[model samples]
Every structure is written in structure tokens, then in C-alpha cells.
Target: MSMFILVSGPFTDGRVWNEVVGRLRESGAEAHPVTLSSRPEADLETHIEDVVRLVDSLESPGELVLVGHDYAIHPVLGAADRRPERVGRIVHLDAGMPQDGDAALALVPDPSVHELLRAEGGPGPVPSPGPAQWQRWGSTEGLSVRQLELLSRLAAPQPPRTLTQPLRLAGTAASVPSSGILCTAGGMTVELVEALVRTGPPQFRKLADPRVGFFELATGHWPMVSCPDELAEVLLRAAAGEGRRLTVPEGESPFLGSFLFDTPERPRVRNGRLDLHMPKPDPGGAQGPRPAVLFVHGGPVPPHHEPAPRDSPLYLGYARYAASLGVVGAVVEHRLHGIADYAQSADDVAEAVELLRADPRVDARRIALWVFSGAGLLTADWIAAPPPWLRCLALSYPILAPLPGWGAVGSRFRPVDALRAGGGTLPPLVLTRAGLETPRIAATVEEFTAAAEETKALLEIIDVPHGCHGFEIHEPTDESREAVTRAVRTVLAHLEQPS
Candidate 1:
């Protein structure tokens, strides 16, 4: 089981997570809360070190969920970037998203500057809003007298230095999975959130990240104090990587004979969570080791352990077809696990490739990648540095540009930008463009194809006339069928090419 590390923002301590920790512990997860120095002199680095030290002491740093609320997000992110491999995911509670070069509080501009001075204490030390403030912030709808009293004691003032300190992310934290939980139940409004995301400060803007699962709760900013039970469940689901998982049911087989292969009974753990489906070897071992194809299914894959079926009809029939053609075919479940950041997703593909090469039934030196839809972005790394084993890449309606919605990490994920850096010549490449695709999608692919040619990338561009995106399976017309047929032939033919 993964462990949960609860981190409180300024003015509060570990006690903020008391209710949340209790519920998580009961759920059998190893939950603990870390307190940051609230001393007037406590700066950003002081808090960052505090969290990093706790993470370092963990038995399994990789099995961690670092939950940060409000101001604590900076230090939590600092620790994550410092030790990217140690932290698995970061959960932000009513906090703004920080970009690569943003300062802590720089992104969270208040709705009005007047509200800050409107409170008591003459703007001396950032006065607490008192009971009325708490009520407006969120509800104590179900909280007992003790909970409310405890909340009062938890409110205090910490140094403003933490916010003033500029946050410098080296793109490492982008590798760590992340999620955001917005408080709509309190004084916050959805329309206001949308406006903030649109207007300025990178913080609110990141909430719209397609990869970061967006959730709303009808509680105040202090949901831990107001609705710990409901808050705990959200964190639990986030920890479990519940994204907009879309599952496609197993499709009808169109192979000469029913697949002689067996579906693995259960998922396996490799670098991360993964499931490998392979074709059963021919009877009496007719076809020994053969060239392999790793099917990279696109996903916002379904929730944890729930129907992450990557084997669409196209993949199923293709896998069977590969087997009949005397080639080993493997379908991989590229469950994002909310690590939708391109860097980590690419790492996953790398790990899966290694697993494929290690299989005795696969011709390790002759492997190919077949990627479809959104997963096309992951091909950037492979394209930039084509492994000798990577004979060819068959990209269907591939996305070779930076998709801000996908929370792309950096310019390297942008193919055209990466191509400017100049690298090894890409191996034989076959790119199929769906004629009916949106103009933006079509333009990006066209741009990529043109750019690839300048780099002298051995490339083949195939246009499927009158074919829509995913037409290969969903709306398979004669044109679509021929296009799919060409894709299969392209990979095999590329394999036959002499080095």
C-alpha cells in the first residue's frame, strides 16, 4: 500500500490533517502528516527542507502522495523536483498550479486587494478572518463544537517570505504525477475559478490541464476542517489515480483463426503498473522467436484496476494478424496513473520496450512501435533517438505538437522544437493522417512531416481519404481498411530492410 504524507500550508501545522489522517489510517493506508515551521523568520527554503527530510525518511519514497494545501504547495513542489524519483504524486488542495518559472504566491492574486486589509489587526500580521470569515470560506455543516474550536486554534500567521521566494522548477516535478481539488462549497465560485484560469497567473490556468483530474467540493478552502470525510475520499481516489479513464470493450476478431494466444490473467508490476498481452506461440513451436510489435494504446485510461482495456478491436485483430504472419505481438496498457506529463509517460514506454526485448519469444533486435491517437506525443523521444531495435514507427493520426491540455513538460515534448536541436536520424517512419481530422490536428502532422524531412528522417506519409479519426475501427470504410492494411505492411516491410 502507498503512504500518504499530509502537508499543511502557512499558519497551520500537522494538526490540520488530523481528521484526514484518521480516515486514511482506517482505510489501511500508511498516513502521516508533516508540520512546517510557522516562525516569523521561516522562509521558503526552511519549509522545503522540512518536507524533503520527512520524504527521505520514508521506507518507500516512490510509494508516496504528497498533499499540499494553499501556501504549502511551493515547498511540497520544491521537495518533489529535488527528489523526483522519490515522490510518486502530489495533491493540491485549493491551491494554484505553478509553472516552471513562477514564484510561490505570484500566481495566486486575490479577487481584490481590499479583502486583505478589510480584516482586523490593521494589516499588521495578516489577521485571521475569525468565525464569520470561516463561515464564509466554507461550511462546518457537520462539524461538532470541538472541531470548530480546534479550527480556531489552528489559524495563525507564518512568515510571508515563503510566498515572496521565487519557485524554480527544473522540470523534474513535472515527472511526478499530480492532481487538484477545488473548493466550490465555500466562498469560491466555479465561474470565478474559470475566470482566474483565463485571466492570469499560471496557478489557476493549470487547473484546466486535461491530465490533472479536476474535482469540486461544496466546502470551504479548509475542507480538512469542514468536511474531512468527503475530503479524505477525494484524496483516496486521487491516490488511486482515478482519471477520466476511458475503456474500449474487447472487439470482434477478424483473423483467419481464433487467436491461439491467452490473455494474461492479471496485471503485472514492472517499473510501474502494467499489463502485457501476448500471442500464444504457434503449436509445436512452428514459429520460433519473431520480430515484435509493441502496441501503445492511447489513454486517459479508466480508474484503477477497472477495465483498462487497451486491446481495442483494431489491436486485437492486429495482434492476431501479427501472430498469423509469424510475428510476436504485444499490447500494453499505458495507464497514465495521472502521470500524464510527457516525460514520465515516455519513461513508461521505455520500460515497456525493455520488457518486450527481454521476452524470449521476441526478436529483441527487431522491434516496432504502433501508436495511435493522443499517445502519438510520446513518440518524440523515440523519434529523436531511434534505437537500433526500433525498426520503424507506425503513427496513426499522431499528435507531434505540444498539447498544453495534456500538461506537456517542456519544449522537448514538442517534436518541431526538439527537431531543431538536431539528433540521430529517425528510423523508417510511416505516418497515417486521417483526412477527416480537425484542421489543427492535420496541420500539426503536416508540419511534423515537413520538419522530419528537413532532418532527413526516413519518412512515409499515407493519407486515408475520407477517413475520420479512429475510423480504422469505428467507421471502417474501404479507404480505412486499406489504410490499416498499409500500416501493417509498412512495419513488416521496414523490418525486412537491411540495416
Candidate 2:
């Protein structure tokens, strides 16, 4: 019989694994459930310690199988590095694997995700959850009524610093076997899973090592809740070294196709300066000028082209998607961070809109802005004092206001207080946060809604509790991605309507 340690996501306590652990036990295996601290509170190192403590207390001399679902990948990987000899194998079940110095949750690829992490004061060591905090998250839908009650009685708040603690696994390799059990049913797209395996950074790249394997289950993000039997079977297979290669199905790539632009440049003056980018459609052409969408990249320091091909998610994926739908999409590069005020980024957006409006190929009537974290705030400022042609705004975890706590700006340039200082009227807005319940994120949205008022909708992807800011771009579960796509579509439709 093998000893199995199953870890759950950030908001969840060990109780999430009750059914799975029971199945493992019934099948003659010993299983332990590991819990992580909730967000905006716990950091990364504390998380690592929690897992280490659990493994050490087991007292089992034989190799242990470690399983991490979602956010638990950080701690599990860290623990394996610490006790490679005792651990037999590691499994990342739909979880993002972290690289050296990269926060675990930061592995999510969305720019809004990066911004959200940044807004939360940059990843650092987080605390383990104590009983009360675990109980709160237990009541979430995935757990059964009895399970919730049990967790409520047994749960605890994790420490606050576990999130930011860096897990040192650079030279240390996992001596035990590893596997990634990806969920395909619940918003987990084949595209994302394959991308994570193929192109994900160093931390995630570790999963592809020869000693590691892969498995795919047609389950949602919470497989233990939605399909315990299937999850159990997959786990058993991996434990027995019977897992197989998991491959994403081939198709006309939904996100990688290219579209041709008219090559005409839209140029306009705003705030006493001319701004320029690719132009939209003109009415006189065979088709009316198409509605326009502008994607603003994050960071004040990195030039738009500096992060070009990698940053091309904007140009290649999103902008192309919009263009395919008859929407004029343009990627805007804001001025470098230190040289210009962050507010100037917003001005640049306004200028881009003006340029789009002036272009003979552009339909100035319908314009939309999609901005991620750093750019999201800048876009918000521009919307606060919206230009005449700007029609709709879709902000993915936009930092409408400055974060309230310490250590929020990790490696990124901090925004000026003036960017979100005074109360100002904002345009129709769609606001999202990673962990909606976190005090800081929730408060930020509340403040944003108060400013934007009536013409706003707030969507918090519950499954993606922590890295909401930019996680969407990292290709979150299909449900989350659909929700975002829907939000963008709805906003675009609204912008196209008579105002």
C-alpha cells in the first residue's frame, strides 16, 4: 500500500479530499489531506512549511505520493524538493507549477493575473489557515453537506505569508516520478493544458521531464467533487506507474489564426498629443468601419516590442480573435514606465481611439478597450475621463485604485497615488478580481462600482479564487474563459448599440 497526500486549492481545506481519501483508504492506501491558506492573507513559504509538516508527521519511511490540485502545486513541489528521498511521486492535478523565484499561482499566464498578484502586494510567504478560515471555504459548493460540517469543525486559518515564499527547486530535481492530471470538462481547455506542457516556463517545464507522466480526465476543475471515482482511478493509475501521454486534440486553432489589416494607420490628437495605431473600418468601404478594440500591455518599463513574440498573446491571440469577429483590434504600446507618468498611458489610449476615429478605414462610432492590470488602471483612468468616441470598457482585474497593503509592487513599477486618488465618474465597466472575497480585491471593486455606478457588471470567477487578475489570459478553465469571452461580447454588443 502507498501513502498518498492530497492537497487542495487555496480557499479549500483538507476536507475537499474526504471522498477521494476515503476511496484511496478503502483501496488499501493511506491518504492524507493537505490544506492551503486563503488569499490576501497567506503567503507562499508558510504554505511550503504546512506541507512539509504534514509529510514529516506521517512518519512513513517508504516513498510517499504527493498530489496537488490547483494552487497546492507550489507547496507540494517545494516539499518534494525538501524531502526528495521520502517522496515517491508528485502529481499536479490541473495546477500551475511555479518556477524558481516565481510565485506558485503566478504561473497563470494572463496579464490580469500578473496585475492581480502585483495588486495583492507581490507574492511572498503566506500563513496556513486556522480552523475558522477553512470552515468558511468548506461551505463552498464542491463539498457535500456533511463534508462541510466536518471541515467547519476541523478547519483552521493558514498563515498569511505562505503565498510569497519562494520555493527553491532549481538544481534539486524530483527523484520520484511525477504526473499532471489535467481536467478537460471544467473550463480546462486542451489548448491551455498542452501549452502548459509545451511552452510553460521553467517550473511547469519540469513536469515534462522523462520521469514525469501525464493524464487527462473529462472532469471539471474540482474533479474530487464532480467525479471522485474518475479522479481516484486516474490517481491510482499514476501511483501504479500506469498513466499515459495526454495530448490536446487537433483543430483549426481557435486562438492562433492570423488576419490581415488594411495597413492604414489611425492617428488622432488627445490631451494635446497625437496618438497612432492600426486604423479601423470606414463607412464608405464595402463594409462599414468595424468596431475597434484596443489591447494595452502591462508594465511601465518593458517596451511593447521588448516582450513582442511572448507578449504577442495580445496581437496573435486576442486582437486576431476580435478581427475575426469583424471588430477592428489594435495593440497599443504605452510609453516606458519611469519616463512617463502612468496616467500618460491612459492618455495614449485616448490618443489611439482618436487615431482610430480619424482613419478612413475605421468606424469611429464603436470603440472598446480591453486592458489588463497595469494597463487596466491606466485604461480606467482614461475611462474616468473618457474621450467622446470611447464607447465600452472591459477591464480584466483592473487596478481601479491603489492596493492597500504592504509589498504589493514586486519588481513592477508602482502607480502614482494620483492615478486613482480622487473620485471620478467612470464609463460602463466590467470588473473582475481573482479572489473576490479577499478584503482588498472586494473593497477595490466596491469602490470602482461606486464610481462607475449603474452601467457596470461585476464577475468573479469562483474557481479561480486567487489569481483572478491575470489568470484569465493564462487560459483558465473553459468556464472562466467563456465567461470572459461572453463579457467581452456583451460589452461589444452594448457599445455597438445606440448610446
What is the lDDT of every predicted structure here?
0.65, 0.57
Task: Count clashing residue pairs in model 1.
Answer: 7
Q: Which digits, one per residue and each the tens of the lDDT, describe model 2 over residues 1-499?
A: 7889998875568887888988888898898987665555656766777888988898775789999876688888888888887888889887754555555433322233334445655554233334333322222334456644554455454343454456668536446788878775433443444443432221233444567777877755667876788788889888887665544322212222221222222332222322223333445656656677776655433333334422344334555556555676666656624212455665665676677677665678777777665454565355435555566667665555433211223322222232244324444555555553334434555666554434343332223354443454444466556555666576677568775
TM-score of each: 0.48, 0.47
Per residue, candidate 1 scores C-alpha lDDT tens digits across 131-244 of 544443334455566766776777776565665567777878786767777776443444444433432122333455654565667865678877889888988888888643
Candidate 1 segments exceeding 4 Å error: 1-285, 337-340, 404-408
Q: What is candidate 1's CA lDDT for residue 297? A: 64
* TM-score of model number 2: 0.47
- In model 2, which regions exceed 4 Å deviation? 8-22, 25-43, 46-63, 83-88, 102-139, 164-168, 174-231, 241-385, 389-499
